[model samples]
Target chain A: MSSFEFTFWTIVGCGLVTWLSRIISFILLKKFRLPTSVIEFLSFVPIVIMSALWFESLFHQNLGHLPQVDVGNMLASLPAILTAILTKNLLWIVIIGILSLALIRLVI
Target chain B: MDDVLDARTGLKDTLPTVFGYIGIGLAFGIVGKASGLSPLLVALMSAITYGGSAQFVMVSMLVSHSTLLSIILAVFLVNARMILMSMTVAPYFRQERTWHVVLIGSLLTDETFALSMNKLNRTQNTLSFPWFNTANLTAYFTWIIASLIGALLGNFITDPKRFGLDFALVAMFIGLLYLQIIADQSMKKALQLTVVLVTCILMYIGLIFIPSNFLVLVVTLLSCGLGMVIKHVLF
Candidate 1:
């Protein structure tokens, strides 16, 4: 197959896989009853996933080496973290984070 | 008052995501162009896959000439979390039509899911297709447009970091995580703190041993499982 054929097919396959993973649970569970335990487990999904993603952002990892903090991101996070606690607004937090990081890059 | 899902409200609620997605999308497009993919293909990938990390990995794998099946499988693994996220939000759409449910699920992403969940908690409103579709498409178009621009600009955007645009999504994640914490009314404060703490600690250690991609799915599953067990045993 040509390179275009390969890339095109690959993209199509990926799109199918992604959409299926997303929609399968909804279709299946629509018929079957979700156990209470499953519901409880689902409740924890948002916070747990968010926490994991957020933490992942604060560190960098290399193959065969321990993870280390990205000091730049960590330092930039301070002001955004504070804004999150104080205002609890998503837009403000993002703006503050970008500006803070921009300022940090400018200074050091 | 009847529950309504106006596009305006949805667009307003999803505004924050626009900022995050544009920067990351630009980065993805730039990388795609550097990988020898055309600008049109890059935008198409963004539209079709609609996944941030998975698309990035797909681009890298394509550059390396990974098999089509392997790319599909890897995409599934990276996005397995979507199944869980879909299920989490499914309860809200139980009364909606099957087609609507499918539509919402197709539009699901980490950012959209978090934002919707937080909005639901804050407003205590029923989830409607109009509201969600509006929000989803806003972020969706932003991402695709940004990718196209990035591809077009290619070498011009050499370093996204110089402008701190690299930090946009991270900041968004931080904001969403904080929102989740505040919006969580399910578990007690102590348990919430424990789950988050355990998630970070376990993920930190897990990253050392496991590839970061696999670690996210495993860490999320383990942390949530442990949180449930703790809740049952203690609370």
Candidate 2:
């Protein structure tokens, strides 16, 4: 009755939505053997949208005040970014990023 | 992978990425563990949801005392990217049996996206769907093992304030962005600018005011419409 109920029932709702998204493909591909060109175009959908989401999450914070930049957040993140680029390794990124933050007190 | 690659290409194509997955997956697992949830729960969510950002969002929401509505809003918005991913694959999948698509879709995660995108870009003919399973299995195993380790030792590990762990996620994204931008210039510009603009809007405007999930909805609908318009007008 009340909206405040902490029911995990929401999982059922989300699962239903997720299921329907892929259901059509299963139906069509099995029965009709859908065309190849259609599949090729549809394949781009994930990467393009992911690129969008990635952009939104990463640059959204830094965009408005760019050029002059706020020293506070940028300083904390720079080490992790630099290490990841240089080493191309995850352990290095985590370590370098955390150490850079510990030393962040010295910067600001 | 065996027949597809020669002996020489083995060192170059597969090893580095697989090694990196071990570490990245671990970072993700431990982060989930540190969120105070059980590792079993984390594994289940990671396996079923198959979404990296949503996993992080769920953990962060748990930490920040977020309302269930807010958590759903954020995740729903975050998972909106999947719509674009699905739509792109939808038309072609019409032939595959339903359970097959469902089996693979449920395991679709970031690594799966990367592997599949690269494979599709290269191949010219009908793809064996098992490649999707290979990619998903690799990512799933890594996330599961790493998270269990992270969960058990989660309390003991030393680090910055919770703020630092938060920074770790941001830094990881930045590094990934830099690599991506280098590979494709126009895409990089679009993505980097998108990242900056969205972050600024969400941080300042706060997701509560505007339906932040609307960003995904708006962009996807616009892109789909543009595709339709181009098909009608240009072709």
Candidate 3:
């Protein structure tokens, strides 16, 4: 297929997958009243998921054993994590994280 | 009071998102353009795709002339978190049309998702479009504007490692996770332990197939689901 075909299908397929993942839960949830305990815990689900995701990227690696710790990793990750924690703002969080990583790499 | 927030409020919330997206998008644009996309086209893609990591992948793939299926698979994997995110926010949008929900889901990103989930958790009332759309629009605009700027003034970013900017995203995510736990201590402890344990186990397993971008998300999600079931049975 042509590049255009690929891009088009990519968009269409992704939109479908994304929509299905998102919309399915809503449809399913409508049929049953989830237990209150489940609901409460579910609320925290994102917190768990997001943290795991960010942690992996910050500390882990693409080509190695159990996330070998590098100085750059810590320097890039620590300050960014701190900024996100302290301010609770996305803009600042991203900026600070990127900045911190960049600075450490630049300086040391 | 029941139907209080609307476009105006949405517009207000959206402005910050737009600004944030624009600033960050500029960086992406520079990177993307240098990698290949014409600056203008990169800006266009930023507006259309309206996602951070996905756009990053798309530009790389497009530059390498990757197959359509390959690009889709890569993006699909990277954005799998959106599935969980969409599921989280789905309950709040039953009143809207289905197409609207799908389109909105396409617009979903880490920042907006974080904001929307918090808003929903705080209020038990039915959802509305204004605030939701407003917040999304803000982030979307920000990405477009930022990409435009970055593309226009492309430059090889100097050693970013020195400023420790690379750590910001991890830090931001950590901060967000910590805040969530603050609302309920048990969940907090459970999440913390789950993150640590899961990371240790995954690292021990040495699975490099999955992208690092997805680690915390996948493990934390699986563990949280397990934790929820355990909590359900115990109490």
TM-score per prediction, in order, is 0.96, 0.58, 0.74
Give lDDT tens digits, candidate 2, residues A1-108. Answer: 112123233333343444444344444445555465554334334433444343344334333343233344467666766785787654466556656655674556
> Model 2 Cα displacement at B103 (Å)?
1.8
lDDT of 3 by residue, B1-235 (tens): 1234676766654443453455457668778668756666676566655567777777777767787677767766777767667766777776777666755666777867765654443455445766777667677676787778777777755332334433544555565555555533444465455544654465334435555544545665666666666556654
**lDDT for each residue of candidate 1 in A1-108, tens digit (9 for 90 to 100):** 128778888888999999999998878877877999998888889888888888888888885788988888899999988999998888898888988888898988
Q: Kindly list the per-residue Cα lDDT of model 1 for residues B97-124, writing each as its tens digit.
A: 8998898899899988988878776656
Candidate 2 per-residue lDDT over residues B1-235, each given as its tens digit: 2224232432332233353344444566677666666666666555555455666766676667677677666666667655555554544445666676766666555444544444443344223446665555665676666656666666675342433444444444454444444443323355434444444443344323433345545554444444434434544
lDDT, each prediction? 0.85, 0.50, 0.60
Residue A14 of model 2 has an lDDT of 42
True contacts kept of each: 0.71, 0.18, 0.46
User: DockQ score for model 3, please?
Assistant: 0.40
| Candidate 3 chain B lDDT trough over 10 residues, lowest sum | B158-167
Q: Is candidate 1 or candidate 2 better by lDDT?
A: 1
TM-score of 1: 0.96
